[model samples]
Target chain A: MRRRRLVAGLLLGLLLGSSQAFACASCGSGGDDPLILYPNEVDKIYVGVARATAFKNVDADGRFSTSGGPTVKDTLTLAYGHGFSPRAFVTGTLPWLRNSRQEATQTSLGDPSLAARYALVMASMAEPLIPQVQMLVGYKQSMTHSIHDSADLKTELDVFGTGFSEAKLGVDIWFGQLDWLAGAAFNLIKPLPHTYDGLRYEPGLASRSTLTAGYVFSTACKTTFGANLLARGSLRGDGVVQADSEQLNHSAFLTQDWLISPVESWRLSLSRQAAFGANKNTARSDGVSLAYLRSW
Target chain B: MQYLLRLSLCVFLCQACSTHSKADAPAVMPASTEGVASKNGTFFLKMDWTTGPKSAATSAATLSFYDANHHQAISVDSVAVVPWMTTMGHGTAMKDQKIVPVAGQVGHFTIDGIYLIMGGPWDIRVTATVNGSVDTATVAVTAP
Candidate 1:
């Protein structure tokens, strides 16, 4: 097993260091965020930072309402992963968030999440047409301060967490051949209702799905385009529907992945959300994310 | 050596985008004469801002309540105004809004101390006690 890992790492190093003439056999399975890792590369660590600005609100009728000044949010995440076996891995992630508006600014630590994934069908070059499938179960523990005023608009914007523990179930599928790769992932997040500030806030179920397609342009460069869809049910305040709490929004993103060295890579992503449709009680936002990863 | 150089380059790129956030100037818009209906169809509240929309300050406006016909003025027991930024999910720092009934002009009230903390889309949420029942209506306004 150790010999196999050494050979794989050496080959990946050569592929990334050499010119584009060499075939990129290791590039297809590795670049898409350590959602899936092969047997050879077991341990992974990453630091990711993202900035988003909410420019306008999409009313319930899908109309664009630019009523308020923009709100900016920044997030920094640190994650670690280890493969327990060839078909299984576990990951833990922690994030810090800051929200800024014209009137006030807030900074706090976000929820910490732990996920366990097991592959049903491991990816292989021999059957590139058949996608590799994996099922993931994750849990996020709320680590935010108590919400002082649930009815306050600033409190709502400043509070990053749901103030409740959340569970996530998802499936990920990937298909790759040569220099082209594609993947799809869907997740359902359920946040347990919790009483905060003298009110029971039952957050509605939310689902997030993504579709991605990428092409390897060269040994060091790869670009991916993806579309993300997020749908959330209305939040209930003491079993009553909170006004304008439901949301359905979509965003398109472009990402550039650079394999900088044998053991390190960087991904930069730009995204625009809720551009055309009428989203329910949601704001339109543009975001950028930069991630640095190291694996061995 | 090569890996260190690449890591340094990535760090530099990330730093280039990070900047200290400064307070943004408020972008004021024209006075709003928009109307919003109560939650239970009790009445429609029409708003006319006497002072132009400005952020980090207070403005005055007159809120007139009209019945279903939109022609007849309707009187209420009490009125309260909350200046809220919907996108930000917060209201102004000023906790109190002063509302005075226009004498002999039923359903017409002048509201003062409507503070807008910042620029953006704001909802002037008016909650009134009519016939011993509380009803609320939201008027959308843009503050500069």
Candidate 2:
């Protein structure tokens, strides 16, 4: 009886933690952002810096083509170890994304996120089909920013706070020169008041699925190119469907690295993606970017 | 080493030529106000090609519609291409294609029997073979 109670308590704790982990409210479609979906099977501490420029026509219907502005975004990330391990070191990434539509309205600010990654299953060396799996949990806070009063005209115009708190579960497989990665994650976004003033809002759930392939160019250098198709569905609010949409975000990227005496290495990468097939007020952003990564 | 060099040279040349061909192709003109129509509403699809030394005396083409999601809707297979000539010796050919509703017409090409569920952005992917040169054009359409 005691053993049963202990098992029940542990299972309950895991459920609560997982629920909290996957809750993130923000766009899941990739645009100019670096692949947050990391590669599988490599063990090392990596630090990367990147910037993205996005031009979006937020109103998918072309009704308000000029309503939303172009956005310039930047991000930095640090990760440690690889595969599924009991504990892994991780930190860093504060994104600053800014939007400027018509000259009359514009806004910008920093989105700060901190998190840790833990591996749940280590791929067996003997079994070729099994994949390495891991769970990532993190918290992100969007710094407040000043916006033009004119931007307050619509709820969609003013995006505030670091959008959502997120929990992620991912799996990766490495076979020969090709590395395949697949993951599913859910984000529970906290509700915020509509910018239109006095309008109550309910943040809905956002989910994503990703697949990536990477190829090794040399012993120390590798380049990866892959496409990730994401779907963001079911936005219910005020007893009605407010913002529900879907988009296919696909990208290709290449990374090069040079080992600096074994302990440390420097890496550079470039990537591009487009948001095609979107419904509702889905924002379409596409751009090319470069990144610098260093390992200690 | 000589054979390897020749193979590499051939690959490089093909890549360069492919890029050039795409760049040289005429851009698809956006449908004018006189031509735009509501989604699912009937609209005439017109295709024109200029005859050249590479132009085939006899050729065939296909017109396919993809939804706003870029998924193919109606694939009108084997649209007969009738040659129409311009007065200035600049050979021109045109075709008025029709959309026929049928099962197994929507979604990706592989899925067995799915039709276009609804309206959105639809892309018309045209594949035409003239003379010996085959070309494809992806045109955008919004279904009301």
Candidate 3:
């Protein structure tokens, strides 16, 4: 029996090489897509990877209420930013995570940030749509602090940075008039019991909002198209392991930005996030993103 | 949407059902508790003990953090020593599951070369941070 046909041909070539690893995707956007930095005024660097999925768990009525099923994450981001003057700017991030559900797979590092953005006004063309107001501040820490892998007890999926110590403020409003534009952003995340773990984790205060629309087609290899609508919520937190919590979702997305020269910029995205009408932890993901941007 | 793209193409054709060989698919080894775990009010961290952590081996410890009433002692910056394996929930990518800090030794810390590839009930967590106040303490050691 020729070694059982060579272990059945190596288990059929590792089961057909397992769908090419699904290109390992995940570029954070946790509450549902849209947020690949849109305050570009030069000085940027981005590297992306997004592959999200959540749909598997027949939930033939077993238990664990509040809607259930879905899990698969892959996030590899290394965003950067700099713009000392001209309305201020400063950013940083370091992420590397790989997640899987039901089968159990966990890779670490994600949830490392330092941000600053400012530009309260600027938009001409006889004021295509003025009101310029963009402000952002960030600080998120807790590297290698489990949420799903290290699991001390807290599983609903989506894990990366939540070891606590956050303080971020946001606002973005751009209603362009010069190349067709429309934007709205609102962010606020606060959870700073200032760890020493004397028991303090109020996953409270989490808000993310987005509403964007873009258009720029200047032929000759220049095209930018966009559309987004996102929402996420979490207020009144408490999870230093009293069960760990936070949930509420909404989603929508569509994008395409390509201009492969003079510094390079390429983006292609598609999203569909779920968990409408209050979802405690039950996930619902669908994502695909590709980015490669560099600027001077 | 086309049945969610055929259920993500049947979950990537069920990812090649690996039959074990990532260095034996980690699972087994854990048990250690030299005692030492603290988290006082307003910040006063403590871990004070642990050595030769099990569940695959390599573990060590000694700790103390401060900021209690501002007497001062909170300079930790960063530290991570997560082991965790709660009845096979999954964890321990093994690479020694590192965590180091000592240089001057102010509450010493070293969980270098960790590899608790699984076993049972292990919550080694030892997150420490200063200058923005951050803290975590866990040493419920156990493995076998």
- Give the per-residue lDDT digits (tens) of candidate 1, residues A1-296: 99999999878755563322211211222222333345555898878898988676566656665434327889888888898887888888888898777667778788888888787876665666767678888898987753324344322455676567889888877665447767888889897887754667787898877777778786678777777677888778778776666778877788787878756878788888885545666668888888887878
If scored against the real structure, what TM-score would every candidate get?
0.69, 0.45, 0.26
lDDT of 2 by residue, B1-144 (tens): 999999999999999999887655433434341222214332223322222112212222223333222222333333222221110001122222232333443211211111111223433344433233344444443323
Instruction: Please identify which of the two predictions, 2 or 3, would achieve the higher DockQ against the true structure.
Output: 3
Better of 1 and 3 by lDDT: 1
Best by the DockQ measure: 1
Chain B: TM-scores of all predictions? 0.72, 0.24, 0.27
Which TM-score value belongs to model 2? 0.45
Worst 10 residues of 1 chain A by lDDT: A20-29
Model 3 TM? 0.26
- For candidate 2, the per-residue lDDT at B94 reads 27
Deviation of model 3 at B23, angstroms: 41
| lDDT (tens digit, per residue) of candidate 3 on A1-296 | 99999998666443222111100011223222222333333577888888887442111121122222126678887778777765667768787888775776667777777877676775443655564566777887776654433343223344555466677787766654444545666777776653323433345567666665555553212223332333223322234232223344456666666555434557777776543333333234678878787767
Worst 10 residues of 3 chain A by lDDT: A18-27
Can you tell me the DockQ of model 1?
0.04
